[model samples]
Target: MSTSITIFDTTLRDGTQGEGISLSADDKLKIAKKLDDLGVHFIEGGIPGSNNKDIEFFRRVQSLGLRAKISAFGSTRRKHSLAEQDENLQRMLAAGVPAATLVGKAWDFHVHTALQTTLEENLAMIGDSIAYLKRKGLEVVFDAEHFFDGYKHNPEYAAAVLSRAREAGADWLVMCDTNGGTLPGEVHEIVSAVGLALPGAPLGVHTHNDCELAVANTLAAVQAGARHIQGTVNGYGERCGNANLCSLLPTLQLKMNYTCIPHESMAQLTNTARYVSEIANVNMPVNQPYVGSAAFAHKGGIHVSAILRDSRTYEHIEPEKVGNKQRVLVSELAGQSNVLSKAQQIGLHLDPSSEQARKIIDRIKELEHQGYQFEGADASLELLLREATGEIDELFTFESFKMLVEKTAGGSVVSEAFVKLNVAGESLYTAAEGNGPVNALDNALRKALIPYFPSLRDMHLSDYKVRVLDEQDQTAAKVRVLIESRDYRTAWSTVGVSGNVIEASWEALVDSMRYALLGLHSPQPVRTEFGQRGLVNH
Candidate 1:
């Protein structure tokens, strides 16, 4: 048997089923290119003819010239119907893709309840669908939907289903944990049994994360002689999710020593994960394994010190292997090593034993006590370090600002802000209106500064988050505001804390603008102390 594994990605089809996840045809194409570059074996484009967007994707994907085979996903022919006459099967053929993945009922319970079809008819649907597609010279992948549950409930019937699919020339017989309830042990035993039953037959595994065991189950199946793995990027799918290819790819390649993607393409894993999340407009969880922002971050003083000496002390694998980097986070729990490491990260050099490092550490603790978190606000931390080290000057001195909120009798509300600033020893005043107080202030501030620094025109806020530090204080509690800003080339985050929400937002906004202006005006090169150019996300 071949030792290499086939990676089939269903992000465009199954991933779109995730709640709040939607992608345009262009977005699907962009992701398809990324996946192809990453060397995924198969890219399940989508169920053609199911929706306008998917149909458009199939039409356009042909010209992408991707290396991966584009698989058109669909169900088996309808019960008691000829495969050639089934509209769904016909559409799959019309898609003109190189492969066809047809899902058919393997669980007897679903056969009886969901499809309301007899066992014989279901088997016929599976067989006819494969035979029809095979006759068209298309590689057919038979998705045995709920095969694990089907086998546990009725092993004989499940084996018969696989036998029929293989006989019908199915290139891949996939056992699916459709409900995602099967344990890893069960997957291993069942997959082993199937491998023993049909020697030399190609097998695959697809699992969902309902039990949070999809990745584990897939690994078990692979160890049990299954050579194909099906999953979605970042584990996106209906309900819980499908197995996460982000976690599976690196584990299979680096840990298991299996030949999945090419060795060079493995480094693109993190970027691909983030790219898919960006196109889908979904937030990739920070704690997600292998590819998340926090996957290789070290915050504790001891951990940072050890990792600085030897990264293997705290990390299982070098993050750079997956296109990510190590980050040393600074907080109250930090030591001098953390401050120095972070300073070096942002192009500032601070001696570990120097008074500058001591002061910066003290200031970080003091600010953190005031509800400031630097872990997610690297720009703000860099600003603090530069100010403490006398490496930067204030870009703007706050004079004063006022906000006016008016509500008409019709319940329509408007907020306006006026700001006075001294730029280059000149006093300037600006006013603007916005949907909210913070927006008005941001608009007024930007209006006052855009002409002085045209680069600021390209800068815009991407995300804003506020957290109440002490809920017991209720309406008067201090709030921490974080703002993420991006210009055309770089993205940075800043943080501020104050008892007033507007004040906190204004503080964060001011820090964001000042950081941008500092980078624009600084005489130093853009490279950090480590000689890496561009902004490094923490």
Candidate 2:
């Protein structure tokens, strides 16, 4: 049997059935072009006759020049209607795709109750729909909706539907777990029987992740003679989800020796998953298989050390193969290996046994002991390395600052703050008011330095987080604040710890601005004979 399988991406069709998923025609067209670039064999556009957005997508997508075959989806014709006159079939043809997939009731329960039609009538609907599309020069795919559950309830009727579609010229007969409750073993056994029942009929599988077994069931169906696998990127779909192509594609190619995409396009799989998630406004799962941020992250000291020696000791495959980089995290749980690895990555050239290296390691331990974790503040750690080694300049030092708040008659609160900075042997003072005390403080600080550094306006704080480190002193507990700041080019995070929340936030904010300036002037470190450090322009 051929190991290569056709990849049918349904992110636009069944994927939009997800609860909060709404996409415009332009969004769907962009996604179709991306899927084509990713080398999927077929891309399923939404049901053409169902909505206005899908109609426009079918019209706009013709100009994209995508290499993949765009397929339109719809249900079989209405009961007792002529195939040529059916609105669904006519709309599918107007969409101008080479292939059209039609879903028909496979379960007797649905035919007798939901569809309110006889089994023989449902069979005729499937056969007539496929025959009509085939005569229009379109390759037809027959989706046996609820196939697994239907086959168990009425095996003969389900097999008869597949036979009718095959006789009527359907190119691929797809088995769908519409309710998403089928087990892997059950899917394999039923698909195996179906393969035997309809000999020479091309078979495919479509599943959902209600039981978290969509991927497992799809694999099982493939093992039992299914050739085409339908799924969505990052598993976006109704209910739990569809099978995740991010997980399924790599697993099939790397573990099972099956080919689902062009070899050169395999590396783009991770980026494709992330791109779709971004467009859908879905956050990427940190621990999702193969493509997540934490998929190959080494956090434990032991794991990091082993990975440093031989990546094969802790990694199942090379991270680069999937376009994800390995992350060596340094926190309270890290060891000397973590420091060495991080320093190298940050371009700090320190001998592992040197006094400077030992100082950096000891300082990190001491700070983390006081709840100043460096795990999320790599930029701050790099700043510390430069400061300790005298590779950086003393930009500025803090002076006394004060914040005042008042309540107006309308129950509105107003706040103001003043900041004084000792910049280049001169005192710079500024004051401002804002919606809150923190915002007031930020405004005052930025105003204080705008004269010395005009580029300070380009950088602003993006996120701020504060966590109380001690519950023992409820009223006076120490707080840790983390601030993320970004300029036009990149972003960085800094952390601070203190008993007062305002003080902690101020420290983190200052560090964030200082780091942002450092990127602007990346001066080389100059060492003196007295073991002092200074910066020299490179």
Candidate 3:
């Protein structure tokens, strides 16, 4: 068995089988570049003649200049057809890619029943398809579709199909757990047999997550001598999804000592997973192994205190090894270390024993007990910590504001808001209209601040979320608004809670602006009864 493995990512092909996962040709090319930069060996671009979008992807990827070979996926010729004259094979050659992966029926159930073909004819089809592709001088990878189930029922026929592809000059005999029912022990056992059956031929495994063991099964195959690993980013695929490369690659390189992705590029694993999730419009699984936001997050007070002295106290490995950070999740359940660690991350050197730090932690606990969660609102936490020390400058103050709504002749309602701010004790007022009440308030607030703080022009709200604190009160319940804002460089989150929805939104928006202004000035850290947090431009 080879020591180094090939990383084959099928995000553009099998990954699109997932519901709600779709990508344009341009999106496909961009992701392919990211995968190449991460040092993956092969990328399955998609079947050329399957869809117009896939056809366009082939055309666009031709100029990508990637290190990874872009393989086009298709199937063997129909039963009883000449391989040279096969339409599918003809398109595969026309794709002009370096590699071709063709999946054929290795299961007798699919052959004798689905295609209604005899066992002998199916073997002939597999051999002819591979031989024809080899004659065209293309690198061929034979995917033994349903190989595991086939071996369980008709072991002889399953072994025969793989041998036929090998004899016909297929470069790789890829065993696929199409139904994903096979366990890891079974995968290891079968891949070992397949390796012996086709001596001198390279082996590979493709798996699904129907049993929630795609990653385990893929690793098991690698343990049993498979060299090329097939998977998708964040495990995005049909049904439960394919083997997750985010989890698999790290396991192979860091644990098993198998060489896959380059050691230096491993740090990019988190960003790569997040990039694909964003383009696919999928939420990042917070607890996903290695790359998730909460993978290395410490929340318990006991765990936080120990991790402050030694990160290995609760962590298995340094999170930075995978482009992730050790996060001290501050909540009502936190202790002094949570406060000190969070402050340290934002460039604050706080004296944990001091009154200001204790006051900040106490207030955070009180607010969270009242249903204000701060895990996603660390910028708000920073503002509170600085404010408690009297170190934060008051950039703006509320004087008075009014909101108005007007109904047009077309049955559309328009909202207008006017905001009054006391800037340097001078009254400044502005009015603006928007698609909704929150938007109008945001516009009016920015207008009022631009004259005094023009840097607010470069900042804008990126995301807004609302949660009801007391659902029993229904419309009268206090609503918590969390707003994420970004300037030209980085982003931050702030939160607020109030019984009135508009008022809650206004509070969060104001804090977001204040944090941005504070970050811009980067005021010096000062010492008092407690140490202060430095504003290092966030």
Q: Please, what is the whole-model Cα lDDT of each candidate in the order they appear?
A: 0.90, 0.85, 0.87
User: For residues 111-194, could you state the per-residue lDDT of candidate 2 as single tens digits?
Assistant: 999999899999999999999999999987788999999999889988888899899998999999988999999999999999
| Per-candidate alpha-carbon RMSD to the true structure | 5.8, 6.3, 6.0
What does candidate 3's lDDT look like per residue over 15-40, in tens digits?
99999999998889889999999999
* lDDT score, candidate 1: 0.90
Query: Which candidate wins on lDDT?
Result: 1
By lDDT, highest first, what's the ranking? Answer: 1, 3, 2
- Highest TM-score: give the candidate number: 1
Off by over 4 Å in 3: 405-410, 424-426, 450-458, 522-538
Show the colliding residue pairs in model 2: none
lDDT of 1 by residue, 1-538 (tens): 2269999999999999999999999999999999999999999999989999989999999998999999999999888889889999999999989999999989899999999999999899899889999999999888999999999999999999999999999999999999999999999999999999999999999999999999999999999999999999999999999999999999998999899999999999998998899899898998999999999998999999998899999999999999988988999999888988888887887888877778788989999999999999989998998988888876556799989999999897999998888665556577888879988988888766765666788998988999999999999999999999988877889998999999999999999999999855532323334222222111
Q: Which stretches of model 2 miss by more than 4 angstroms?
A: 385-519, 522-538
